[model samples]
Target: MFLLKTLTILVAIVVIIGAVTLASKKAVHHDGLEIEDLNKRYRMMANAVKQAVMKKEAWKKEAKAEKIRAKGDDRSDTKPIAFVIDFKGDLKASAAASLREEVSTVLEVARPDDKVVVRLENYGGVVHEHGLAASQLSRVRER
Candidate 1:
């Protein structure tokens, strides 16, 4: 669309220049002020057209992303055959709660034959927090 718009603008500018040169029969010289004015106006219009086309493309992409997000909200009873768990956080009580919730959600949606992969990264904090997180990953393996 942008390409077509740009080409159209370019063609319009060419036609405008041709008409201006033909109309100013007595002063069609290159050094004439009217020619310069026509060139400036053409450039300005082309730039404006380009900017508007870019804005339209951006809006289209945003709308497409919104549609995908809306579609993803629908849930089905069938569980996925494979799953992955991403565990990356400091070893704190707050982090532990977040990790626990993520694990529990995965387990709920995961099928019996599904597999979970946890990427553990620990920054020393409460010992119990890390212990609980390790236990969560171990539970995945036990199943």
Candidate 2:
């Protein structure tokens, strides 16, 4: 009888302790703006963390790839690398011609070995003017 009574008391104590723990668990609430701000902050933090992880993983993969490539490179010789430039435009006031200075600056940096591939796609303008513009690009190619 004493053991039974003691067991009952112990069970009651355990139940009360469990109830207290459950009751003590806290919940959070916020107003709309506060919730929105919190969500924005969380998104920013999550994005930062994601970017950091991605950078770390990318560096690891790049290092591993470089190591593999270096191993193979020992048996090969470096060849001259080539580049091709693809120019495109439309016959509008906002065409590449408006940026001639900027484009010239880019062309000035090009090595003589570089090849340029111009694609003419102007469909809206003085139709004959596009022909003249394309001819100028051909002049650049000859040079």
Judging by TM-score against the true structure, name the best candidate.
Answer: 1
Tens-place lDDT digits, model 2, residues 72-108: 8653324332323334556552454533433354367
Model 1 residue 131 distance off true place after TM-score fit, in angstroms: 1.1
Poorest lDDT segment (10 consecutive residues) of candidate 2? 28-37
Clashes of each: 0, 0
lDDT of candidate 2? Answer: 0.55
Please estimate how well model 1 matches the true structure, expressed as its whole-model Cα lDDT. Answer: 0.68
* lDDT (CA) per prediction: 0.68, 0.55
Relative to the unseen true structure, what is the C-alpha lDDT of residue 39 in candidate 2, on a scale of 0 to 100? 40
Instruction: Give the RMSD in angstroms, all C-alphas superposed, for model 2.
Output: 21.6
Task: For candidate 1, give the lDDT of residue 42.
Answer: 72
The per-residue C-alpha lDDT of model 2 at residue 131 equals 61
Per-residue lDDT of model 1, residues 1-143, tens digit only? 99999999999999999999888995754431111334446756865676576687775686577568758966565644545455666646456666677777778877786767676666688887778877787777777
